[model samples]
Target: MAITRRHLLQGGAVAAMAPALGLNTNVSAIGTAHAQSAPDGLKWRHGVSTFGDIKYPADFKRYDYVNPDAPKGGVVRMFELGTFDNFNLVVDGLKGSLADGVRLISETLTTRSLDEPSTAYGLLAEAAAYPDDFSYVIYRLRAAARWHDGKPVTSDDVIYSFEVMKKNSPMYSTYYQHIVKAEQVGDREIKFTFDGPGNRELPSIAGELPVLPKHWWEGNDPQGRKRDVTATTLEIPLGSGPYRVKEFVASRSVVLERVPDYWGKDVPVSVGKNNFEQIRYEFFRDDTVGREAFKGDQLDWFTERSGKQWSTAYDFPAVSDKRVIKEKFVNSSSGGMQGYAFNLRRPLFADVRLRRAFNFAYDWETSDRLLSNGEYHRDNSYFDGIAEFMATGLPEGAELKILESLRDKVPAELFTTPYKNPVGGNDDAARNNLREATRLLKEAGFETRDRKLVDAAGQPVSVEFLSQAQGDERSILFYKPYLERLGITVNIRTVDSVQYQNRLRSFDFDIVTTVWGQSLSPGNEQRDFFGSESADRPGSRNIPGIKNPAVDALIERIIFAKDRADLVASCKALDRVLLWNAYVVPQFAGGFQRAARWDRFSRPEPLPKYGVSGFPTLWWWDTAKAAKTGGRS
Candidate 1:
């Protein structure tokens, strides 16, 4: 059955109606596979589903529906990988994602809605105005907003955030490339003028800009700040967000305490949220102990690794009776691409036929069954929606130009007239592709001898799949059988997350599987992931080392797209080109989020557009009802 955005939005309503309507939507047993069923519930214990998270019972579960009219006081414990680094809030660092996630803890702006296309709305900025030239955008902050320490936030903070981040962080250059200058109009207003031709990406700016406290950072030039990082311990700066960092344990843990005087305490967006009286983020070495701790009620949430344990391991009668309510939030199909990335720098993989042969030999369905327990979906296109952009049809306008350009760069056989839109990966089709690959191998000075793929120098063709040690079991399992069939031995090497990151930074892998989630704006950064410049550079996300001029041009077209429709069409064309080249054997796209949480919280009649959890950051706890039910442990 085709899954739609409407179907995803109706998820909770459909789930609620199931029992009353006598429908058992037991997706537990997906397809022909039998999955373990949950027993009748006692009380659902609140928990998070994360890999290797520290276990703590103090995490609170606040529902969206039950607005507990209670005083604002509770610490929200979140699991952190490590200490707060200055580079996180900076735009130039590889660790910007986590920094962005952490910035929500201690910042505020004028607007309440972060989903708006204009960065004009947020807790700190009320409205943003853009000039006709797209040179800059001005943000007006609400005058009444105050930092947690009772200091008023002004334009200085905005400038400081941009300047400091641009000077120190690695990613700042990528996102803040259009900035011309930032001017403070008043204590409550700031104007950011852009210097380039680009649409106003408000959501990305709002999410990316972490409002820094100007008072604390005074006289700290961005250049000076970068050099003044000699101190081993730095005090947590004050901001007007809901949570504040209370303590840091270097490598093991970090704890955040709820701010009693949070500015938006009464706002509906924040009310009855950040429920836990104290949030203790404990870091562990591995998933085995994390699961054990969760089973023993020592942890509140475990994001990943719940699949295998929840299905096969955690079936103890005592644990099963609690009736763990599963929640699945589906949004528009991900803008990010997930697949087996090829190293285009490698000669054998450069040939489209060879790449397609590997993709054809691999049975994604079987691999998914073995790896994800049949709880997955195949990726049809890089853009996974049926929106006009994802809609299947002829590529026109700029898309046509892109396709035409890539025609020769990609294999002629793959994009021939009979199969302009050929669905890749079939056994017979794979054998045909293999035969073609063998021919290409010969052309590239390699020949198959006795079914073995080898170079003219008699060196065996092999590729190593490198991934983060603990989190990449699915990728490892999926490609193992396929590579073997092509007589190309694939070596799967699991390394520590830190090591894996280091290797990616150094471009030291033949093949790798990485999860790429799309930003809300979904702009130029999308193309940069696979662009030639990115492929050759250190610390770039383009691990494939692809350098084709046609691919680069297509990526550029996708970025200059004027609207969502144009963007989608351009992206589809680029996706087709990539697929034809067999640059990456597309893996299963993200399906439903397999998560279990205690039933302490409920949503109002109309959940927000993104569903129960407000866009990633704005989750709260209904303390009054939670207390009545049984307050924080």
Candidate 2:
């Protein structure tokens, strides 16, 4: 079955973002029997896909959703939540924020089409070639590709960028973990060889590698300090993308000017995108001030992430006079889980019984009404509302067959029972939930002593809910008391964005509110999000610290499934196990993106299928509308 935006409208957390990436293959490691290669040479193509065929053929012009002739002018001013002190995006200890358009200044080997479900067209690489089993793949770089300094991008630069990323960033290292090596095969060809055959997402993951400039990072900074790839620095890096850092004021603002002579400006994937003449990002300390800035004309676009604000806050005169536009765009994203994640690393939440108790104690119904104006729905599964991938009803058929293989290891009820969230909104239901929670805690070897839930060692069951913004705890405040009824101590920790990232990377909190963004085509990134290996790695998306061996096997199954049928079955099986285990107290997600923007810009008639909204990317300035309402004044 095809997943659509309508299904995602009911997704938990990923209802608002673009999501993908991969992990260790579970299929038996490459062995002698699978050592076959192509007869003559690899076949070259303009794009690549995992389960489906490439949507656009080799000779297609621009993507169907973009306007090839969309005029580009005017500035798009936006806001970033916190401060930035580093220009290095993939480095560790990158405590400060990086410029928003940093990636715009650099080009990836392949660029994805927003309208398609699973596709990535060649960007810097004119063509991609691979053998039958996908053991090795080669990219033919376009000779026309040049750096911001007019230097040709060479094979050495690609090799150097891959080597540095694998060495410096844990994410890139894991994402590209299966790629055994990268070697220059031809004058313009870069080949990435994998450890084995049959893992399909490897080629695309390699294609997503951001090709960095070897010369600039290897050179000295303006202050004459030796450049270090592992360390954070303020040196403006050179790029070959649509935008260049025009200027910047540290921790305050950044302005990027469009590159008139960008090497890939006319590339099929680049058409009608990055249309803004200039992109400005102003840093703000609070969401309230930032929203006010949009109303005050200090900013041009503001996407409302808060449901409360979306319901009652956009009643300003600008909206009344039609100077500001308030609308919701239905997204086609294959969403992932967002919820109060239990740090399974914490001793208090180690037991599945205790985790179930915590879930039972959460009053999502009352909290949704109080905090989100009842415009949200609680998440029921890790991959909730994600088309056919989500595990629902009772597991059967191929999903059951897969689960049968690990019957002894997984939860026995997973084979027979459907996962459901605890229900509670009023006092009577709340009391029933409390009683069930108490029963579950007792079964988990915890007891109520002095009205406090304690372990065998008499240590109180305490949880700290970590959030980047204090205002985000509106729902948490309602959840806190219910847990308290079960004699569980709850603490809500509010930290700045930078600090929150640091703490999350270190796995320093007991419980954190986080989301694992998903895409329609789920692949290797699932490993990073839930694989046992990622549980221990710092900076990984496995915030709940899952380390189940069954999960590791399931992830490999999802990554190596031969076709769409196999992929869907494996994913459904994985979702069931995760949901039954209860690693998170699933939160609510909005059906559509409640966005507020100035009336000065216009988007293409049809927006991209698998995205939140093509803002400041596919949307361009309307000169007539801008004249009536000042744009980026």
Top of the candidates by lDDT? 2
lDDT, residue 414, model 1: 36
lDDT of 2 at 67: 81
lDDT of each: 0.50, 0.77
Put down candidate 2 lDDT per residue, 286-403, tens digits, no spaces.
6788888988998988867777788889888899999998988875655667788889887778899989988888888988777778988888766655666789888889988999
Per-candidate Cα RMSD to the true structure, in Å, reads: 12.6, 5.0
Instruction: Give me candidate 2's TM-score against the actual structure.
Output: 0.93
For model 1, the stretches where C-alpha displacement exceeds 4 angstroms are: 1-87, 91-101, 108-120, 147-149, 197-207, 214-238, 266-273, 305-310, 345-348, 391-398, 401-444, 449-452, 474-478, 519-521, 599-606, 611-632
Q: Candidate 1: what lDDT?
A: 0.50
Candidate 1 lDDT over residue span 329-433, tens digit each: 554333344677877776767666666566655666655556667666676665543333342444557666657766767546434432222233456764665
TM-score of each: 0.75, 0.93
Worst 10 residues of 1 by lDDT: 10-19
Q: Which parts of model 2 have CA positions greater than 4 angstroms off?
A: 1-40, 92-96
